[model samples]
Target chain A: MNRYTDEERQLDELLRSASPRRTVPPGLDTRIMARIAAHERRRRERRAIRSMALTCLALSAVLAVVGGIAVRSLDVVHRPETLVLLLAGMGCMALTVGGDRIGEIMRRL
Target chain B: MEQPTDNEIVQRVAAGDTEAFGIVVARYSEPIYHLVAGILRNEARAEEVTQETFVRAYEHLDRFRGGCSLSTWLYRIAYNRAVDSCRRRRFFGLLPAHETLPEPDDRPRYDDETIDRMRRALGRLAPRERALIALFYEEERPIAEVAAITGLSPANVKVKLHRTRQLLRKYMETQ
Candidate 1:
């Protein structure tokens, strides 16, 4: 075994004996659990909102496609208002589906 | 009753039994707090960082792949949080206040004066150096495990460990 110098031994003894041992605060558990609960709740709410938004966007896309087909079948695709409405609906659908991806890309930039 | 393993507890927490996480918090809070307090030397900030560490751990529980022991993983998270808190405080020109040593009544091994000297000497070291000392000596972690927790190569850890011990001894002698 390597022999420790007196100073090394003293320092080791001091480190072993005098290391600070802070008692965790009494209410730390309660505080952490409350924070965790809040976080879970917020995450659940966000997931709910995202799913709802996705459902709405899916419905909007279906409506836009159907409406576009109907307008084409009815020969009303020539009307500027119908065409604008169709384009806006399609744009909204794309934004809703790709919003998170767009945000990720922007952040990387 | 025998306690569940850390892996078991982690699996339970991931399965939505959030109460299982309380067991993890209870098991780790003291070491985590002590580690943070050792570096920051401020009880309030240490407590905050300790709490934040667990919160981050919980948030990323799924990412814990059991590559390291739970304690080591938790220490890694605590270490990062403490370093970040230290940096933020430094940026704001806020230095940690000198902390008082533990009361003699609490630790009958050393008198208040010796503990105080050691604490002061520890405080004089850089935050990472203090962390290295705490991990190696106070926590009784092996050099390899310390390297894993601190994200340092094992060889680097050995060099720093030797150098930090020398510095601590020098600092204490000067004090």
Candidate 2:
């Protein structure tokens, strides 16, 4: 047991001496801060694009609904098939307005 | 003026005062670098991993509930990052043969060739074991904190650390 303690002590000293505290390179903090800034900028840009895409999607849906109701109340089409066709046209318009935005958001993601 | 505690800095950063994060980065970067460099044994990769650790901690600050000290959380991130970097290097077969060998600066400081042997022995140990050594000996962390950083139970940490020391001794004797 005594020999073990002695050996452990020697090893401890040896390890300590062998592995001195490594010095960090200069400007490491600057480099890290720069990276953090870049990351923050990217995050902000992503959030802005996402929010804009959501707004466009909401606007397109509202326009489609309002356009459909207006056409239905006008009674321009006597047939249910005509009303369905009008709604489908409005739906196509909405997709045209918002499709690219959605695609952009998806690609970014 | 007294410097703010880590919790205080964290609160400030979470409150949208992003500059306060610089304090955390500056305060922890060196020790994180040492711990990471010890594990990866590559200064450049260690630096990159250290920066990555801070960036990850910043992004995930909301998840920090103060269950552990900030340094412990940061150490955990740095350790995992270094390990991942090591794995990636190994996968690409780009890991150097002497990744963990001691630097040439030690030649003048320690005249004994045993120091070289000891460093070579350290290189032979697995990366996880080297992490345990760095956290235990270099950081002088308590077993419990080491456990927290390494995701090991305290009992496991103790056993592994004991075995690591014994292995180091054996290597030193035989090498």
Best-matching candidate per DockQ: 2
lDDT (10s digit) by residue, model 1, range B1-175: 9999999999999999999999999899888888887778777788889889999999999999999999999999998888788778778978645554443336677787887777788878778888888788877889998899899999999899878878877877788
Instruction: Tell me the TM-score of candidate 2's A chain.
Output: 0.65
Residue B46 Cα positional deviation in candidate 1, in Å, after optimal superposition: 1.2
At residue B61, candidate 2 shows an lDDT of 95
Candidate 1 chain B lowest-lDDT run of ten: B96-105
Off by over 4 Å in 2: A1-4, A75-109, B100-110
Q: Which ten residues in a row have the lowest lDDT in candidate 2 chain B?
A: B100-109
Q: CA shift at A52, candidate 2, in angstroms? A: 0.6
Interface RMSD of each: 2.2, 2.4
TM-score of chain A of 1: 0.60
Candidate 1 TM-score to native: 0.81
A1-109 per-residue lDDT for model 2 (tens digits): 3546877777776776667567889999999999999999998888879797878868777986787677757654475766777778776886787777777777777
